[model samples]
Target: MRKHFFGSAERLHLVLMLALTFSTGVVDAMGYLGLDRVFTGNMTGNVVLLGMAMAGGTSLPILRPALALAFFMLGAALAGRLLRRNGEGWSPQTSAALLAVSLGLWALTVFVLLAPVQADPTLGSTVTSALALLMGTQAATAKRLKVAEITTVVVTSTITGLASDSRLAGGKGTFWQRRALAIALIMLGALAGAAALHVHLALALALAAVIATAVTVTGHVAHRRAEAEAKTGAESPSLARD
Candidate 1:
């Protein structure tokens, strides 16, 4: 029997990535709304906010967004360096990276719960930076998974693809299902995050952390199962020849 509705491991990776896409929306919402107008996951939004801050004439923060961008790049660089030797698709490195993201998010969640960002500027900045770093790590790990157009962090390209590749655009509308799902999931995640913030920032971070943990565990199990099945298939072929 197939292990999932999308039977292949490759398709499973796409679904896993879509989950992370949702988590990214949650993280971004927490950052933008709770953490002083910063974006932890959506670097494109962060960049634009940074540009506007630099342009002057507003009380918009410059330092926090700038720090978030820096830490995010650092996280991506570190994750990429760690994953450089691995080939496409999930690996031990992918699991480790995701686990690290999970841990980081949980740690931030606890910290926020203990020291509410509204009470301390330093803590707020620290949480914001940490979230950015974790998000960057997640983005890199998802990229390594190579689930095609599902990048998990930003949906701009997915939107563009959905529109540009539509039947109205004189092209065969392929992969629209995943693309549309990615877009919708991110939006829903953002809504969830915002709603959670009405209660507490920690709740939002905790939700993201939980999703990260789930993704890490599920992906690792699926990868191991796929590897074992391949091994069994190879052995069966040799045994048949004998």
Candidate 2:
């Protein structure tokens, strides 16, 4: 189990994806509170809100959710195209860095040119669309990584996994630890972002981008180290045989 854990790319990807999930939570909170009542990452929430607005059950603008949903699709489309071109050469870190850098720039623009930009409904919508785009691209790219029971954009399945895979549920509970961590990290991120909003709403996105960038660098280093370790292990076995 130790060798499996150390040798497997799945474990590394899962850890990094959990970080991305936390970033998603931060940005989703930023979108809902700071932007127009939209969820930049969680499409489930956006869909429900869109339905309610259309049903006249809420005062929320339909355009907000519609725009967020549209931009998210656009982002997913962009990721699909990039995936086709790069094939396996493209790593999750690459997509994450793309998103973090773009969002970082957007956050800077909001800070510099559009301080308190959320008060301007039109500009907020535009910014929210951009944020949703990054999130959707990230969601699509992360999906390609093929980790089980965890998606960075939402935790419905992760929660389900945590419940269903528990030892009491007649399952081995193998992923309970990671599943629980995903939920915890997302919740922590939500709390952090909401608190930062009281100070400066843009800080949420900035924090999320910083976390993404850090994970991107960390994943690269971890991948290199795993490769080196695997090579040394392979060589040691061969040397002993020789």
Candidate 3:
């Protein structure tokens, strides 16, 4: 039954996206707690921080958040261009983008471990911006995959859907399983991220990168197998539910 459920392409996308969402939570925690309150994944939180920073009172950073937002948009634009012509669901371009995200995270992990990132404020901000850029790429890729209710970065809408679509709201409470799992995984990721931060920021980042790599490899392999089976005129597992 588990394999039968995962045979559905949409369900596979949902699972992979939820995994990425967990990675987002880990890095977001690292960003907020370790990087001067700048959000690397959650743009909404960054916007709020930017607003407070512009108010000109506290030690809130104006440049970090601003740069993070800009780089994030830039990353999204780049991913959009790369994926503009492709249809929805996991594709070669999607794999490429996800691979880039994983590699970028690994690169950042190495830098934090080897470089004096803590000693230089500019370097820390640079790392945060890079993280935001990678997350933007990830977000755009996940969006292109068209997994409903799983954005892989933020959960505000998911939270709203959880409440608004509940039986109490007269809705059928559809997809409450994935929705609730998305919320829980992100919180658990934040907890793990914070705990890892006590050891080293690099460790948290490495964990995120590992998850990205796992998603990329597994999703790509499954997609390829589905496509091959389709070409052979066999019933593709991905379309079994369809």
180-225: candidate 1 lDDT, tens digit per residue? 9999999999999999999999999999999999999999988888
TM-score of each: 0.95, 0.82, 0.93
lDDT of every model, 2 decimals: 0.91, 0.76, 0.90
Once fitted onto the true fold, the runs of candidate 2 whose alpha carbons sit more than 4 angstroms away are 1-8, 85-113, 222-242
Alpha carbon lDDT at 123, candidate 3: 97
| Tens-digit lDDT track of model 2 for 13-45 | 787788888888888887787776789889999
Residue 136's lDDT within candidate 2 is 80
- The lDDT-based order of candidates, best leading, equals 1, 3, 2
Write down the TM-score for model 3: 0.93
Better of 1 and 3 by TM-score: 1
Look at candidate 1 and give me any clashing residue pairs. none
Which digits, one per residue and each the tens of the lDDT, describe model 3 over residues 1-242?
Answer: 12434877788888889999999999999988888888898999889988887888499888888989999998999999999999988899999999999999999999999987777899998999999999999999999998878998888999999999999999999878888999999998899899999999999999999999999998998888877766765556557869
Tell me the lDDT of candidate 2.
0.76
lDDT value for model 1: 0.91
| TM-score, cand. 1 vs. native | 0.95
| Top-TM-score structure, candidate number | 1
